[model samples]
Target chain A: MNLDLRIPMGLLFTLVGLILTLYGAGTNGSPIYASSLGINANLYWGLVLLVFGGSMYILGRRGQRRMEREPQKPADTDSGAARRGH
Target chain B: MIHTELTYVDWIIMLLYFVFVLGIGFALKRFMKTSKDFFQAGRALPAWICGLAFISANLGAQEVIGMGASGAKYGLETAHFYGIGAIPAMIFVGIFMMPFYYGSKARSVPEFLRLRFDEKTRALNACSFAVMTVFSSGISMYAMARLIQALHVFDHLFLVMGWPLGWIFTFSIVLSAIIVLLYIFLGGLTSAIYNEVLQFFLIIAGFLPLVLIGLKSVGGWQGMKTAVASIDPRMLHEWKGIMHPATNPMGIDIIGLAMGLGFVLGSGYWCTDFLVIQTAMASHNMDAARKVPLIAALPKMIFPFLVILPGLLAISIATPHTTTTVSMQGGAIIHETNIVPPEVEQGRGLVPAKVNPVTGKPMLDASGKPLLDYDMATPNMLLHFFPTGILGLGLTALLASFMSGMAGNVTAFNTVFTYDLYQSYIHKNASDKHYLAVGRWATVGGILLSICTAYAAINFNNIMDTLQLVFSFVNAPLFATFLLGMFWKRTTGDGAFIGLISGTLAAVLHHGLSLPLEAHPGIHGGWIHVLHTYPSDMAQNFYTAIWAFSANLIITILVSLMGKPKPEAELVGLVHSLTPKPDTGHATWWRRPEALAVLLVVLLVVLNIFFF
Candidate 1:
């Protein structure tokens, strides 16, 4: 599969989300959240990012599978027309 | 007041963040097999990626630090930069100018100048841009270093080593520069782009919570507004005192906002400047290129709330009551002092509050006010809101934002040096491999130059002032040359060249010859030939842009009319009237550039009306 951004971004987000989530859940009801007005921002935002990142990973995986099945094509480098790799 | 509350957990988070950033750079190193991957990200980036990257490229210290600084100092006037100054110009670029950039097959903005104008014009822009990028990179580096010092991020280590504060500051800057250099040197633009996207997320994750907590602490927006109203009623509205330039905090009203900032500075930056444009130019197709800035505008419009709200909230907690002197006009406190206080090195508004001799703590004023350093708005907000690990993440996010800005400029500089200056002048028939090698060398050279400029940033009192000075010198007149050349087929190369040079001279002369107003905030360091100062540095900037742009427009039109025009056949795709529009086939409402442009423009109008 190509180096699609969704895959990497998803992976990174999921990793960070998991870390934040686990730490936050373990440290739930701590006095620290008092500074943030009693909101467990880490746990909440981590779950949000986890769901977002997971969906992105799924979508990227589907795209990668489709690309693998399809025939490869060369970039449109036709002269007189602007194309990639300029 | 909130104190620096970093802990072991925060250190772990930061360490992990660094690992992720460097790991991505090293992982993407293989993509650097060709210059295409390094410089242009192989021109295969999706619109959303490039769009985020475009804003993130500029999401540097200037955006966060300077805007927050401005928010604290000027209150709602800072929004004018986003609404009037940025949105209109960005729309103009997306709907009108993207064709010449994406469709004309130009590698860089300077290259586009060469295509449309003469060799001299391109060289002029290329040289100025290269120098500007380095200087800007240095400013971001300096800001990050300064923030680190002000926030006392490495105080524990510094205290342990018994290091002098200056040495610690320098070390912070060098450390930032080295990290940015590593990433850019490894994966080049793709790494920068990917990191920028990450930085965007990190910034939101870091700051959004801070804003929410800040608002909650301050008793919500209305409560904060009422509190700020007691300090200065003018702080609550965007267009307050805009009719009178002197009395207003920004020092210019409708004319300066509309003509100077919106027209000259706005068009000059958003249209002619190549830093952000380079990101948009990396889109997968012309349609994507057109959408890049448009999509970025969606976020750009909302960004003021993210960065500026922190500054507005700062006034509620640490009131600008002492040290940072301001004049009361129309019940708003317009800043009287622009330089950093002698007692503080962090530049621009860190005034000391009087203390109670009995307890030796900060003494309250007659109105029972806290002493404030306006420049410390965003930093203090972070210090106040988060605890331990979360604080570390926020600091890392701030650090990431600053580095992304530096990387953006460095990457842009290397490409311009490679494609525009080196290929066109130094070495003509070089292989792709040879050029790639030069690009890497240029990257190193750019970082070195930026480090030198970062040291120079120490002499300046404010980052925003220095940036405005650079804009006045280079970008102000650029849009005139661009507008005339691209639209008017009659514009000649010689005419364009003469107009550009003379216009730049006009900007310099206007600033130098004008009488210095007492309210002018910035002290001229390098260009100290000032006859007089304006009431404010902001006022001087707007007037300079106006004069320079007018001179450029008039001169270019006259010269073009006098000179022989390039043949229409030769100017087909370059000029608007002569060239046929491309059938981009992006017919869907959201995908179409015009649809987005129109929607954004409507939003801008609604915003202005509301603000008015």
Candidate 2:
């Protein structure tokens, strides 16, 4: 539960985004983008993904830092009240 | 259709996705120590995570492809699947039913039934649900593998490796099944939930671009509307022709749509089905659990755009033209043609007719017109617009969807089988550690069974349709039993069990007697006798649900009145009237489940009117 899901999500997107951005740059004017109507969709969408992924990574790191700085609270007080076993 | 190509960059992108998914499973491995952890994520997930997983678990390949197919066939009317069919039931469950589920602290939906009803009812539900989930997962596997083969996604790679072209189906199926099996086995429900959230975002990433580029190609919404209007102006509006069964593309009137889909089948699936509810049940507390469905409802409603718009785009865009090039591969002449959907007629647009595999001819309907294979709408759109790099991403998204969907069913199956069937019936008083091991084995067994079913599906295509029909029959009357049991504390186990059996029988009987027009006298109904002929299959399905639900409700009420009810003391948390209201804890008024439900309802109404 301590592991922030966004950290992994952010890493995956950032890596894919980087790859896409570089590929788009290398193939900018190539005919490979013709199906995408001559627009470097990979470049633009990759940048968009990069920004989103970067923010998620930053936010996740911040959340993790905050959790570490604060004393770890019990996961939930109400969990004890809820039934546990079948 | 010409096979789309993938470059090294595309391969890298796809490989990165696989690495990340498996990495998360490994990262979460140590945490999954207990049976609770394995089956229910230790009941520790936060609302947003659970919320996304809640929707994503249901957002399998069938949803992505099926909705797109429906969008092409029914146009904006397809929004009814969310607007009227799904959203209300989701809101209803969150607001009215979550307390009973989360409050009673049942491990699975069947367990919940056992607490509120009896052992017999639980056994009936658990067995049916177990069978249903495995088959559904298998169906997803089959669909994904076939789609890969149809798209020729790995054909070039297979050829390069000196593998037969037919092996792609087996390779894709086995590979995806193993991937799903490994993750779930490693991290249990937590991995599935985490991967589902990732898959949710990836689906958006993949399809959102398709919609944008497609709209831009066709000059945005206005241009797309104009293009669709030329096909059928009614297709542009969601409710224009919905007053009569024969008029609308869906061939269902408001009553059938509201009662059958919205009230019966929708609630039955969203509220009672363990696959989705299990995600909500994994939340940390009652408040978070309540918020899960409400949170999911927002994205769930908006998904029409992400999924269905591509279908509209597929049909609206200019007809695809194929250019063939002949080349020599291993001294054999290879004719490569660009595989895009072509318009057979003016209104048909890019939708292609269903072709007979053996005869290599278009399949004709009872009306003599060719049957349109609307399932191609989304795949063709992905292939048409995306270049190699993004195409790989798009296909990965599709594969991710299939895997997550399979994982959802597998997790749900393992839980039900472990807790309800194995622990309760097969062997009682087993150690917690013993059950955890059983759960892991169940996960493996479920995937293997799913693989067998997937292969079975490949050989017998009607098996999917037949299983779906059987599930609907078993599922349609379910909400009524739950509704009475939760609200009316007087309902007894005998009443529920008999009511459920009778309801399923009613559904079978109804389906057998009623026939959809332009269909044969078998799976399409009317096997017993053609007493009523529906205008469309959708109408037939809705009415079947309505009949089954009505019969169950009436019979359940009648039967319950004749039986002795459980004592009030025993029914406290299990009954709606007896249980106290759930506290919102530190949540703001705006963030409360009821408030969110209200907001979702308003949004649903606005969407209906906007599209109307």
Highest TM-score against the true fold, candidate: 2
lDDT per residue as tens, model 2, B1-612: 223466667778878899988998899999888899999999888899999999999999999999999999889999999988888988999988988888787889999999999999999999999999999999999999999997888887898899998789999988898789889999999999999999999999999899999899899999999999898888898999899976788888888898898999899999999999999999987778888999999999779999999989888876655633344446454556654432334225556778788987677877787788899889988887887788888988998999999999999999999999999989999899999999999999999999999989878869999999999999999999999999999999999999999899999999999999878899999999999998899988999999999999989989999999999988988887787667664567887788888888889889999899
Error of 1 at A42 (Å): 3.4
**Candidate 1 — which pairs collide?**
B515-B532, B515-B533, B516-B532, B516-B533, B517-B533, B517-B534, B519-B535, B520-B535
In angstroms, the error of model 1 at B3 is 2.3
Please report the candidate that would top DockQ against the real structure.
2
Please state the Cα-based DockQ of model 1 relative to the true two-chain complex.
0.29
Error of 1 at B47 (Å): 0.8
Listed in order, each prediction's TM-score against the native is 0.88, 0.95
- lDDT value, candidate 1, whole model: 0.77
Full-model lDDT, candidate 2: 0.88
Give the runs in model 1 whose Cα sits over 4 Å from its true position.
Answer: A67-86, B157-166, B318-372, B459-471, B519-534
